[model samples]
Target: MPHLTIVANIKANADKVDLVKSELLKLIDPTVAEPGCVQYDLHQDNDDPAHFLFYENWESRELWQMHSNSNHVKALAAATEDAIEELSIYEMTKVH
Candidate 1:
């Protein structure tokens, strides 16, 4: 199976930036330790503090799908339902 890359762009409510960050940060350790997870790093926009990004590389599409529906991920989704302003997921494969 080919490697998969995921770029997740998340925007936090301006007034809930801190709360959002705390919630997202909680997933890092577990996500990184999951099987097939090559890299899972989180980033905050330099100019726009409320904007966040997740750079993740997985071994395959199946593994990524599993990760997406994992307990922790589901918990995060429920926990931050109202705190998130925008959530976009991009799944890609390298061409070159």
Candidate 2:
């Protein structure tokens, strides 16, 4: 089966950009160390600092789901509650 790819975009409230960024940064190391994580990368939009994106690849959708439900992910939700403006997630399979 093809690997699962996730594209997550996070938009933070103007006043909370730094806070949201810090919380998002906390996910990298832990996520990269997870069982099925193939790649996990985070990026910030140079033109819009409040916008952040995560590009991730997992061995399978099930493993990615497990990672989403992990304690660290929950913590991120809690820590950034009310600080985010919008969140979008896309799950995909590589075509090539």
The reply for model 1, stretches above 4 Å from the true place, is none
Q: Could you give the C-alpha RMSD of every candidate to the true structure, in order shown?
A: 0.9, 0.5
Clashing pairs in 2: none
Residue-level lDDT of model 2, residues 3-92, one tens digit each, is 999999999999999999999999999999999999999999999999999999999999999999999999999999999999999999
What is the Cα-based TM-score of model 1? 0.95
- Pairs that collide in candidate 1 are none
Span of ten consecutive residues with least summed lDDT in model 1? 1-10
State model 1's lDDT.
Answer: 0.94
Candidate 2: worst-modelled 10 consecutive residues by lDDT: 24-33
- Local distance difference test, each candidate: 0.94, 0.97
